[model samples]
Target: MPGSASPHVLLAGVDDATEAVLRTELGGRAAVRRLPSGEAVPPDAADEPTLLVVGADVPAPAGLVSALQTRTRHLAVIVVTGRAGADDTSALSLLAPAERLAYVRADDPDGLARAARSMLDRLALQHAYRTAQAAAQRRLLAGGEVARQPGEQLFGPLYHQVLIGAVAVDAAGRVIAWNRKAADILSLRNDAAGRSFPLLFPPHVRGDLREHLARAALVPSPPTLFERLGDDGAAQTLRMSAQAVTNPDGTTHTLVILEDITSSTETRRQLAERTSHALLSGDVAAAMTAGDPLRQRLQRSAQAVVDRLGVAVARIWTLDAQENTLVLQAAAGPHGHLDGGPSRIRVGDPGVGLIAAERKPHLTNAVTDDRYADDQDWIRREGMAAFAGYPLINDGELMGVMALFSRRPLPETAFESLAGIAGQIAVGISQDRLLDRLRATTEALQRPLLPPDLPTLPGLDIVARYRAQGDSLDIGGDFYDVFPLPDGQWALTLGDVCGKGPTAAAVTGLVRHTLWTAAQQDPDPAHVLPSVHRALLRENSPFCTLVYALLDPSDTPVRLRVTSAGHPAPLLRRRGGRTRLLEEHGPLLGAFRATGHPVQSTVLHPGDSLILYTDGFTEGSGAHLSREPEDLAALLASWTGPSDDRLADRLADLLFTDAVTRWAGRLRDDLALVAISAHP
Candidate 1:
């Protein structure tokens, strides 16, 4: 037992009124010391048991509480708090052990005094128990009998009231002494005094307990372990520590300490689970935006879930709207192969299909026992423990289903995470489908803006190649035309309008029609381009770049008139493989009324070609190097390939292939090339 010294109470941050109340309530019970304003914390060393009382008026009382706890192991606390800072006061509770802390409202000074007195009583009991336990351990180590005064009489009553469970088992592994707290914690029978200590645990853990006890009896230092008991739903985790104590009769006894840590373990598990969910959500979101194809991106998302959550299998299905069915698009983990599994499930079918039909989630911890889960025999064979299926719905439309099977039972948190992932997957699918529709619509609108086919003219091999920028989802503004005009002449115009989509497509139509109508009135390239430019300005349309050429194939050497309106000059490839740019320069059309559309006249001899193209051929997409006009001229100069009616297409293929190879198929601008050759 502790020396019969009086207990001390340290009062800090308390009003005179509260101090008087505490002193009156604890009068003659303990020595009361009022702390100075500077010394808010009690001294670490005290002659006897000590308690600290903190008032709510103290600035940052929670900090003081935490500091007091770390400064001394012997002090107990009674915090007088108000309703205002309930969260801060609650944090103080976790800082100290339950038995060593108490909280009372500041408004009730009487209640504060009562809490202080109760905490003091607990401190006294703890001090006495420690003193008696020390004496018992000393006697045992000396191989001497413990005297009755400080042994059973002093220790017995205090041991039962200790906060943690204490049980002493003899060398035979039978319980020799069991405290009231131990019985309450273990809920063993009244006859537990002589029962084998290891047998007190459930059958599965008894062997582990026996081995731990034996190891503890041979070691000087106590070793600890956290053991979980009960089934998955109601499991209780205990932090157990054991050490051997030798008795006076030369017999060995092991003292075991048991602390119920089920709540704390669950808290840690929940925290870890929440962190995993956040990372999983981030990973799935990243996968959704990854540059992979739609199916590959979905597959990556499925694989992420299995890798992050340790699930047995994860699969994603996409809706085939025409068939009204779910098609398995991605799979990971066991059953990862898409061929062998149920690749297609009709709406209202079992499992994933049912989720899609209902447009809701289906979650069950026991997949084998759930009647709604499909393929129960396979689940059982694979030892599947949990199943979660969520319908991938966006804006009230079913997109698909995402489902997973876990070998271990999953918690409610897993279902919540999966639901969020399902929504992301649904959005991914919807976005891809929407893009597909957009490309289709844009393509349909784009086709009519260009000539259906090049007109076949005698003595002239005319072919054109139009390639829209590959990287854009919107319709390109580049257009090309080859149509016969009056007086045995053919008009060839290739131009690129500003912007994209509907507005650009409309402008493209206007430019093509205006040029065709103007050429009918006059076959001169200069007059035709300026007329188109005037029409655009009259309509308040966006500006454009154009290359217009009037070809008269009936002439002996095929006379040509080409003009430029802020467009690249046409390339003229001579019959001997020499190349040169035509001298045609002008301002871009539709910007100003004073802009020029300068025309250049040239004669195309047999086996010679004239090529007009847009800027997309020179400027590649993304990080690709720009192909200058000189580069195109050099390319044309080096051409040893055959020049047939498909010469335009062959040249376009060569240039486009270089761009694709250099930039990995990401072409930035739209391209249009028109080639006119005289019997080449």
Candidate 2:
């Protein structure tokens, strides 16, 4: 039967009148059973009895106390004496264990019945506490989250297994309940149940605890750490965490937990010091090497850590940006194949599991432990009996992780060490990334400077363009200009410098400024070419190419005079759909020591056009025509009288779009175009 079904009583050593009085008082309240003497009580009777009433002063059998202690471990035993002195009470305390004993005056029937009823109530409570504690243990062992209620008793062997050092305090800071572990650590007994929690702690920690408790009560969540002293009088560090217990009526109580973390804290401190030294000395040495040497040095450092710390396996995993996955970098022990091999794990892959999901340290004591048996296959395959892993995070971002696995259970000290080392690794990775970013930024800033909008010219519609070579690291060394000379003539020039990137861009800038100065000094387009070419060759190499032209649209026939310096000849198109190349013969600029080069002149009617371009247009393996010079002539011959901007935009689209499609999105070089159109 259930312990709470009915109140049970075992009666002994009462006179007939007293027995009659007791039965009259408790007959309806209790289920009364009779025992003649302590010797005659049945062995199985202890299970059925809730209270045992014996004569307090009666001389019982020698083995009576021992027998009662054994059989009635769960039963409450009450002693009644006709008349007893203080010494008798003291003797009774020694005779019976406090957990099982209660004393009452036998002459007072009312007092005897009250004592028996109170003992039955306490026994029922203890039974319920054990039951609740058993249920909680099953839940915890099954890996389920279990919540507790305020003032609810927790008692059981299994409860102690999960909760090592547990204590409960109320809002007022009074100790409500403490388990065996807490009591042992605090050197407290049953009398400490209602004492203030502050009195149990050392003087220095008492005020801090009160403030923490008060803050915990005021906050919506909980506080994680609090301090206290140990029973051995040594300074102890305790972690006091609290959960708020709320009732349906909105009343609140705090369920505080005291965890002894003295050993764990000290272990963390020592591990941090060791990790700092290793990172400072070892990482620097490893970073000094190149390629395989660096990787080997890193692996050796990891191996040294495993040897010094007595760990079974250690591994490092790094993030791969190309694949967007984590790949094992280095490893030691039975799973050494993971080192420098591709073991890609996505952010939330099923096989990757909770280690990366939580972004914190994950620890498991045994592979077969009931709490994690559901993942047993993975655990065994990795040869991980005890596992601890921490993320390598820098600036609050996860870079990778360092993990240690053991075929045997790991001590708490090992967990602390691994966590500290993982943090140091994170710092090293952050530093490497920052340096790489700085280099990339410095390289990206060297592109050629180009004006957003070209200057407008009266009676002339001009379109100028510049493009960078796709294969080039920086910008191309191309330059173009369309400016009016001082003598009422429009002068234009296009040139290609020697190289690429910052050096080429610098040469282009120098040539551009020098030609503009030469044009201002001598208004003749023919004179400007030699002067600018001479200035460019002085500071630059002989590998340059240039072209200069002068257009006087005010003349009746619209005269055009042009000169070339190793540049592509200009192409001209007439209104009647005939095109020809204005191939003026001249030596390439900066090539030979030259004196005077002849100038070629031509006249254009209204509605005629000319196209000037860099080699990027004709250098493509596949152009509009198989022959590049013939292709340029054909493209100009087919031109409609479109606006300069419209024709330039369409030209760029046709050239780049066809090139991108044919090359599968690869552009081998830059292309520039300058179109000059005269309106009728």
> Highest TM-score: which candidate?
1
For residues 1-680, what per-residue lDDT tens digits would candidate 1 score against the true structure? 25574677888778788888988888788878887766644543433677888777666666776555444446788877774443576676655678888888888877787788788888888888866776675655456544332123222555656888878887878888766666666775556667887776778888888888887665423445545454334677887878776554456588888888878888998898899999999999999987788999999999989988999888899999899999988999967432136889888887777788888788888765433465667777778888888889999888998988888998887888888898899999999888888888988999899888888888777777777776456789999988888787888888999988899999998998898889899878667877888889999999999888887888769988888888877899887889999856888899976766667889999878888888877775632567678888898889888876666556667666655576566667787788877776
Q: Write the per-residue lDDT of candidate 2 for residues 323-379, one digit (tens) a residue.
A: 657766667665544222345666544322235556777687765643322345556
| lDDT of predicted model 2 | 0.63
Query: What is model 1's C-alpha RMSD?
Result: 14.9
User: What shift in Å separates residue 143 of candidate 2 from its native position after superposition?
Assistant: 59
lDDT of each: 0.78, 0.63
Q: What is the TM-score of each candidate against the true structure?
A: 0.68, 0.38
Alpha-carbon error at 125 in model 1, in Å? 33
What's the true lDDT of residue 86 in model 2? Answer: 22
